[model samples]
Target chain A: MSKVRERTRSPEGDLPAPTPDAKQWVVYTQKREGAPFKWAGTVEAVDTELALQYAREHYGLDEACVGLITYEHGDSVDGEYSIGPLVPQKADGTDGDEWLVFTLAKRGGNHQTAGTVNAPDAATAINRGTAAFADGKACNIRVVLASDVHETTDEEMVIWRTHDMTYKLAKGYSKQVRSKWTRIRDNPAYEQYQKEDIETHF
Target chain B: MQNMLADQLANIVLMHADDKLMLGHIQSDWTGLAPILEEDIAASAMAQDDLSHALVLYEFLGERFKLDPDAIAFDRDPCDYRCCDLVTIPDEFDWATSVVKRWLTATFSQLGLHRLATMTEGDLGDRAKRLLDEQTIQVTHLNRWMTRLGRGSIESHDRMQAALDRLSSSAGMMFEPPDATLTEDESFCCGRDELFTEWAKGIGITLDAAGLSATITLPDRSTGGGRRGEHAPHFIDQHAELTEVRHSDPATSW
Candidate 1:
């Protein structure tokens, strides 16, 4: 709803709007369990926490996703500053930062964290990673620094225990109730007959 | 005794279904009109979830009450529907108010569903358990939006505070049951007092985390007529809109 407010001039006679501290985060979505994280889209937020909320609502809601992870675009370094395969480089034994490299095994499929690479920065890691682990169709690549990942403790994981309810599982309804028509006639081939009749009519 | 309990159970379920249907309709109103494209799509998805939940409950009620689900949902008069006033309040295009309302209603529903999932009596328990996953998703989304808006820009923060203050009066009525008898039923899992305590604690935690604890006062039992099927003024219009298509051609089939 719109609210009408009296115009009041500031001492500075209307200072320009301050720029937002929000950072652009690249979002990846795992559509289901065991699926790879695909580059879904981007969101602007102040931190990973808020970025997650935006990412979940924006990229995660449109599909049946199991999880979403986001990384700041600014976190990337060097070559082209985009998510993709990189040119190969000679191995220099410098013992650099550990970066987790993810790649799509096929075109328009899940982007899995295929392997890790030790390199000076994220760009080199992607380059080395793609050269090392890239299959024929490694269409997209993403690299995250190891330090960004958070681990959950056993105690904190307890909140996820939802009273052992199995109703959410489809298999929970595997046992079917006997149809009321069974009392009228015990026909083992009832389903087959119904299927044939429907097919014939159509 | 058994019949009375069954009737009470039906009433409780009916209230939930009605609340969901109304909330779902209100949320769908913002489908194309939300401030942002992402939020617009998200709200629409959540609205679909709410409607799906309502349909499930309506189907269950239809079986128990021996009526068609469509008739139960659309053909009833205003007094026959048992939704609370909190969900029935019009948002008047205020994004902040809608966010607050969605958050409060989702939290209340989540707690209620959790308790119902533990019920040992009937299939409602199983249904409640099944619905928990979707309910949790909606609650998390709404909760995040609530926090974001509450602590966002100065104007947004002010709007949120005002919405919370205005809506808090009837917020307590969410925990109110249709009758005193249902509370005592062990299968229902919780009484009004217990549910209220859990709800208050949960809400306090959420608000505190969002940094709005000191700014807004949580309203307790003040205005409540929803339990007896008395609705807020806006509910009639909502009911009309929801039933418009269904009423237009009662004899037609899609």
Candidate 2:
């Protein structure tokens, strides 16, 4: 019955000029202090500040995350996906800027923070990172300049709230919703309804 | 005296809860329809945050009043609700208007919650403090969008400006006292005039950065608005749409 919903407008003229898309930034989340950060997702933002904000709102709030980091998508260099674990190479060096290293455990698994390497450039950083972190256990290695990775500071670690956040999680509503349903229906019927609800809704 | 203070606190809490509920409902409608995929997810997540914040406030009131939180949220008559008209105004799904409206409200909410956090009255202060932590994310995102779109292309800049001009008057009305009796009590909410000054100052800095200008002045207290329960027609329809499911089965849990 909303007036805006009922109202219809005709096209006035040609469409406006299209604006260029924002840069993509890959996000990673650390579940707790001292935990290795794992790949979470990506967000599009114009700059590092906005990217970190977007990452916090999207990935950080999606679960119980203590910290998160983001880097420009283009800034990362990914090693080839191997059928098995990658063998540690002899590409060792410690000459230049720091590069944060992340490693994949398997083909489809998420990349997690392993360690760091010091190299002159991205290519050398990846080489040195593979040499240091890929110890026959990781299937792939990824490296990005430490300067490009934006992390949540100690003060900003309240990504997960102290208040009751059960309202957004599915399990938060399960108990109350089930008890309410049981008031009118029998246990069997409630179970069937729960099944359909999960399939259709959740 | 304690009872009166509690009543005023409840009124302020209701105003904030209702504002967030309506804002979340409207913003959620744009989930699949936003301008871009990333923005769509970001806006939707913030909408969920708003809804969760509303539930938290409603639960606070529920414990104090011995009423169910869901009933407090959905079963209220239109006049009993205390959200500002700025929140209920239709954005027509326009991104510029949506972003502008959120910026204006988020700025006010940040200031309002800051006042609540200063209060030593029970868990209200603690709850507000917790909510303020999350409010930073919304304000930062909207402020950046305001600046980015305002300084973007000519079309975007014009759209943002037009949206700001359209919503400025209602934005000022957000400072109106939900209860006229509380107007004289500076301690009730740190004084409406003072709150407006802080709000306008915060808003001005962002507006200046965005290169967008609009004169936002506080409205007269005598002129009643949504806070006083005199809602516009759009709110009536929105309220119906929001409670349609609950209305069908008031006793059933949703």
Candidate 3:
């Protein structure tokens, strides 16, 4: 049987759903040479403008003499966001312990995948990344930790170049990697048998 | 600085200082509770700056009256406070109200602080001006969000409008006349600068058109005097929170 994805049927079906309750994000603005702007608190919106607009109403407007903006990953990457793993939820309602940090330098530098973080939030992760960057002496870099990131397992696998055989290379790197979103089987441990098969290639 | 004009000027200056102190007090409530972690931390820094500016003015005022610092700060009642009515309203948990309110306060504060900074008096006058320069940084911070939301999505536009509606009316009191002490000096004091007028011209809207969601009316004098030792009972709790250790065993230093 030929397989067809659901979104292939409808264009409007492509939009991501709204973030659920208690999973909302609040925005803060670091104004240029100004008091940190504490705009209104709002839930994570679908679009950056939506988030920023909510943020602006919440934090700016009454004050004058500046442009309004919130600098976050969603504002930049179109759909590359959320391509990896869905952010896991913490029982405490704050972000999870695990984190993935990225550092971008050299005037719109590519966010060098510095590594992942197991820290609490983006700020702390950035602090660590900044120290690392400063030590390495890489000047003029923007540090952004992949906020709200986590996973069920670090050593997971993605199906290697074929759909017929259950042969997945360990650690998710493959000749043809998935994009947008992918379902790796209900149980990631199922890939264990394939892990044994990959040792031969090594 | 000795003229009634100067004295009135002093009252005006006091009003500005008092407003910062009071606004700072209210804003600090959000230090740990802001919606986002980054925002909460950022807001906390701003709160500290506001309080620091207040301290600068309070120190000057303390020297004038020979009163202890806390007495000028926590001891004063609400009616005694020279803060504009805009700051006294309960903090709406919503960020819209907080930002809009802060935005309004910062704009006026920038002008007021600058005026004080340039005053002829060398002592507090010069000091207040320096504080004002620092405060301008905050104005820049809040203004960025204003433009974003003002030109943002429809939902954001409505929310901004609603915040304006809710917070605008209280703004009138920001410019109300000071108690007799403020009127004592004129040369170095505050003038009824068309702040509202300038604000409208700079931003391009009357308070009504700005989309504030609430109306503020100055309360009758019965619950008056946050500056001269009259205050809400809630202030008692605040004093307790801030001064518990300091007041407890004053002989024991931390």
How far residue B66's Cα lies from its native spot in candidate 2, in Å, is 0.7
Where is model 3 chain B poorest over a 10-residue stretch in terms of lDDT?
Answer: B1-10
> What DockQ, on C-alphas, does every prediction get?
0.13, 0.37, 0.02
lDDT of 3 by residue, B1-254 (tens): 12321355445656776777767777887765675564575566567667777777767766766655555665543455566666655554566678888888888788777667666654766786566545655665566556655555666667777787776765655655565343313522444444445654544443334333344443332333543334446555544554455556655621
* Interface alpha-carbon RMSD, every candidate: 9.5, 3.6, 24.2
Residue lDDT tens for model 3, A50-163: 444344434432232133334443322211123232222221223445444444333333333344444465445444544443244333223333443221111111101111
What lDDT tens digits, residue by residue, belong to model 2 across residues A112-142? Answer: 9998889998878877888888888889889
lDDT of 2: 0.84
Rank the models by DockQ, top first: 2, 1, 3
Output the worst ten-in-a-row residue range by lDDT, candidate 2 chain B: B1-10
Q: What is the TM-score of candidate 3?
A: 0.50
TM-score: the better of candidates 2 and 3: 2
Q: How much does candidate 1 score in TM-score?
A: 0.74
> Which of the numbered candidates is closest to the native, going by highest DockQ?
2
lDDT per residue, candidate 1, A1-202, as tens digits? 1121112122456643664657788777765556656677788766666577667666655555667767788664423323453444454453688887777655556556666778787767777776766654465566778667322222212112123323333454332223334543566577778779999998
TM-score of each: 0.74, 0.88, 0.50
Off by over 4 Å in 2: A1-11, A80-82, A153-156, A161-163, A166-202, B1-6, B186-188
- What value does the lDDT take at residue B234 in candidate 1? 71
Point out where model 3 deviates above 4 Å: A1-202, B1-10, B180-190, B203-253
